[model samples]
Target chain A: MKESLVIQANNLSKKYRLGTIGMTSLREDLSRWWTRSKNGIPKHGFDQAGIDPTRMINDHEFWALHDLNFEITRGEVVGLIGANGSGKSTLLKILSRITEPSEGKVKVKGKVASLLEVGTGFHPELTGRENVFVNGAILGMTRREVDKKFDEIVDFAGVADFIDTPIKRYSSGMTVRLGFAVAAHLEPDILIVDEVLAVGDLRFQNRCINQMKSIAESGKTVLFVSHQMATVENLCKSAFLLNMGQIIYSGKTSDVIKKYREDMEESANLPISQRMIREGSGKCKLSGIEFRNDQNKVVDSLISGKSATIKLFFDIYEEITAPMSLSLGISNSTHVRIAHLCMKTFGKWILPTSQKSFQVNLSLSKLELNQGKYYVTSFLDDESGQIIDWVTDAFVINVLQSDFYGTGMVPPTSQSIFLMDHSFSF
Target chain B: MQKQSITVLKPSAGWTGFDFAGIWQYRDLLYLLVRRDFLAQYKQTILGPAWFVLQPLFLTVVFTLIFGKFAQIPTEGLPPLLFYNSGLIIWSYFSHCFTGNASVFTANAGIYQKVYYPRLINPLANCVSGLLGFSVQALFFVGYFCVYKIFIPTASHFEMTSAMLTIPLLIPLVASLGLGMGLWMSVLTAKYRDFNQITGFLAQALMYATPIIYPLSEVPEQYRFWASLNPMASVVESFRFALLGKGSFSFHLLCYSTIVAVLLLLSGIYFFKRTERRVVDYL
Candidate 1:
């Protein structure tokens, strides 16, 4: 059977009032009324109040989302992707009826349950069993319905033994498990989930993913909001990329992801000197970084499964009596941690030394990473677990596609990290 | 996939429609909230729900000392203890619902911003849950009334009337009025935030405006019109009149208050729905 349109949002918009002294105080409220009336600008739609954030004048409104239009048929799993503060949350809030759109509207079929953040209505003081009932009610489940799914929810959360314990006494992981379990069992016709699913232990996340997959497969219309591209690619067939409160692109997940990557690369390809936006004590700074090929030549990129060295150049401003360790984290375009290596794991430490300048070269004999642009984040940590300096996105390195086994079986971008080669002949 | 085709959500048109049905749909949530508020109220305190009883008992004693003995305030020839206790219970119920409803949005900002249910559920829950606290305090008043009647037979003229039936009826009236006003303040407080503090002071002022301490007979004829204009003034007067059999009770004023309560409730809900969408950005 062909799918029918279950959700259609037309020219939907949500405007947010912003300013430091905004939305609070009677004075701000009066002034907002004043400015809104004097200007006679439709606060909805594309208002001219969206000045550059840096050049912001206090007491001005901004359209968080504007002129967004999309349609989803029954059983369609759609991904809504955006950079931070791209109005993803606002859009979901509007769709979920938590907030109304300042302009336009969204038409949805049947009941819609949105998990903008899982466990929203959970009470810490309430027992897990009590919260399960209360939280289920918040998600629009009847008491009898919750009763039917009660044991399954507890078993799914793996908290049956502690179901009667107060959620405050339960570990945060346990609270999150119960929360996610209840949310997963919500049998709504339309499901809208935000980025909160990225939390919880990895095993729990995997279980949630399986639950979401089963729910999506059962012909429920779903709209998923996430920044994690891999999760979106795995779950959504169609995707929308929101930038600056606008739906700039809407198409297949692959093409939208490609556009998103280009956007990330554009933002990240700033001059190296200016890209050292990091946070830590001023005791050390990553002055420069260099990537070297196996032939001892400095290069911007290295071939996959080939030998390379990552040299981090730093300047120590002050002498320290405590031990220090150098750590490197490699992350993908979606900011997923691909791998982490620290010299302290190998019992190597930089003792209290008066060396003003230092360089640590990490040699990789066989870099099994697949083709993708990766970011290097370097950290200098003191013995007492204080960060001397930590530079996030300190440098960018691109790994080139290559046939590591000399066979044409190169891993695709979907599963593009650390795949070992093996073969069995019978 | 489902039978229903579409439901369009937009900025509501005209006077915001009250979703009484929506509140009914979320009745279970409302029940849980009432339970949570009634129970979670005195978690850390050693004297837990007993304080609900003690607070009114202590207040009744103090009011008896100051108003009955010191000020010699006339309770329309009724026993001062019975008179003041009657007004105090009703006053406290209104104040609880009124002030608590005012802070509803701010207190539940954590959950309100993250979830979607009928926004009315919050205030409705507070109004309903406040009864639990009132019930405990009312029990104390009953016992105190019994003791006063048994101890001082000459000072009391206790007689039961069909009007006493209004006592049960008063709960929903006071609750609806307070909830209506609270709903109004809920949105105002959410936007201004400073109103959260002001509502407490407002409640105190309103208590004076109502006949909690003094009887309506003392308002003086010239000022009675202004005093009776307050919607709750009639609710308090009628309640005392129904129970104690002696206080200024006008049939027309009761009708006036009933009309005002209905209007306040509808308008309060109207304003609440309008502000619900607007305040989220600020919150």
Candidate 2:
């Protein structure tokens, strides 16, 4: 017989009305009352009336999570991987009963404890000991259970000396440690954590990961979501990759990470003009950006140890051309910028006309970037004063590996610097 | 090829029901919150818990001077100080419950957004903590009653009746009213926010509408019907009548107030339950 599943989701989907506020107008209130009076159930439908023409608005409906289905058996530790808006948090919220789904259903068999954020359910006025009970209760643990594990929690948090002190006085690190300890010791059947480990230092994070490993080993289910692929790969046996509110892949953790890397590469290969730059305040803006090969054809992907050209196309919006400089940086999925190249020493390429675009191509005898997603940052500066344009990560490009790099099977060895060459003297 | 039969379980609506077992399991949390509320309010104060008694005493003196001496409001032949103190104590409990519970969502938004718990625990804890405050004030009333009985022996001859037993009975009733109304208002305020602005004004208006400073007998006979219809009016009157045996306590009015309280409490719980899971989204 197949093992029993602790959590089951069938066609679970959540849709939120884009901009509707509260159900408070007299008419809406009356209709809600009528529906509840007639059926003894709160109505769950949205008003489809056209937007008020007086209001400045455009698109109305946006599905935060489309059709999603998955399952987890007892003792299974699963990782959820996705882009920022890919519905991972939404799924966790639904599973944790924080929000209701717009369609479909989910069945969870045992107690669930979710650490959506650190220090949740902690009252600043309450003592650390008091908050432990409150936080544990909020996470679905009994008071007696928390009491039984109180010492362990205090020990793990390393706040034994300050447990009697009000949490308002605790440092941010202490607060996070105590919060994680209470959650880890809560002993719920299923644990759901969402990027909470990102708050603490590396040591605490490692401790949390170890605790999660122990929890998983004890025949409990775990659902972990994070942008750190290494952590996900180390902690989870299975994984689900989500993109654009849909599950793109669900299988082995390593395979899903590999697939996500490939997807990133594919997106990075898009032309610079088509890059989707987020709308917000940044250091600088790119007037024009494009990547081209020696043949002058726009290219997005480059093989490792191969010649390639990066064209920095821009127009000088400000006038202060004194040793104007530029730098290019590359980063990985975790957003750790790993490399930087500057144009201060290189010969300057002057614009042909005022307010005109210029291109500067850097010829690499060999592309040293590893097989991963890398973004470029182009900076412009003038000596004795101002930094004109410092557009960082303006565009992304993929650096593929050739057979000489050894079948692309070996992970990149560089922690910070991308090695340009490797040779053996025999 | 043999097709495998998969057993799929449908999500049960029963999971949404009140998990009493869960609440019982988290009792320590309830006690911790009650302690926090009790201590935090008076942590740095000079008198500490003595402030609880002073609040009712101060209110009673002001009400006696205004409503008793100046307005000359009748107290059904009961001593003005005792009469006003009893009403003020009970009314304070209800008002505190209302205000504290109504602000539960807004006040704890930081925590609620980050965690999940039976939201009912919040209002329940507030009600219990407010009860402690009211109990402390009630002690002052008892002391005042005892001194009045000893020194002012001729002032309406104090006597405890079987009705006195009803004080404990009415405590839960009054609490239910406040919690229910507060839960309803808190849910509404999460979205409207105008309600938060108006809550203080509404609470003051409600105080005048209820017979806290004076007896129901002081109102005009024609308006007695309207005055008695205010659920809190009957609740306060019933509490004073139970303790002092000198105020109106009609069974019919009590039945009406009880029905209203039960209705409010059930509807409040229903509205709170329906909205608690989603209030964070709006907040």
Q: Report the number of the highest-TM-score candidate.
A: 1
Prediction 2 TM-score vs. true: 0.77
lDDT, candidate 1, A1-426, per-residue tens: 124877888888776654434246887667667888999963432222223353222345656787888888888999998765567888888888888887898888889998977777778777899889889998899888899999999999999999988788998898888999999999999999987778898988888888988999998888998867888998899999987788999999999998977775675676543443344555766677788998989998988878899887777776677888989888976778888998889999977778888888889998788888787777788888887776655678899978877687665756757757778799
Q: What is the per-residue lDDT of model 1 for residues B1-283, given as tens digits with 9 covering 90 to 100?
A: 2377567878776685677788899999899888877656776679988888878778888999999999998878887778888888888899888888897777878777888898888888888778988888777777877787788888768644567777787788888889888888987887777787889899999998888899888989999899999988988888777777777667788778878888888898888887776666667
TM-score of each: 0.78, 0.77
Q: Per-residue lDDT tens digits of candidate 2, residues A1-426?
A: 234777778787766554345635545667778989999965555422222222212344546667778778878999999765567898888888777776787778767778898667677877899888877777777678888999999999999999999999999999999999988887777789898888788899899989888998888889999887888988899999987667989999999988987776665555543443222121233556555654667877776656677766654443434445566776765556677776655655333344445566677766776666676665655554355555435677676655535546554545533655566798
What interface RMSD do all candidates show, one decimal each? Answer: 1.9, 5.5
- Scanning candidate 1 chain B in windows of ten residues, the lowest lDDT window is B1-10
In model 1, which residue pairs have backbone atoms overlapping below 3 Å?
none
What's the lDDT for residue A168 in model 1?
A: 85
Clashes of 2: 0
C-alpha RMSD between model 2 and the true structure: 9.5
Worst 10 residues of 2 chain A by lDDT: A47-56
DockQ of each: 0.47, 0.26
Local accuracy by lDDT, each model: 0.80, 0.74
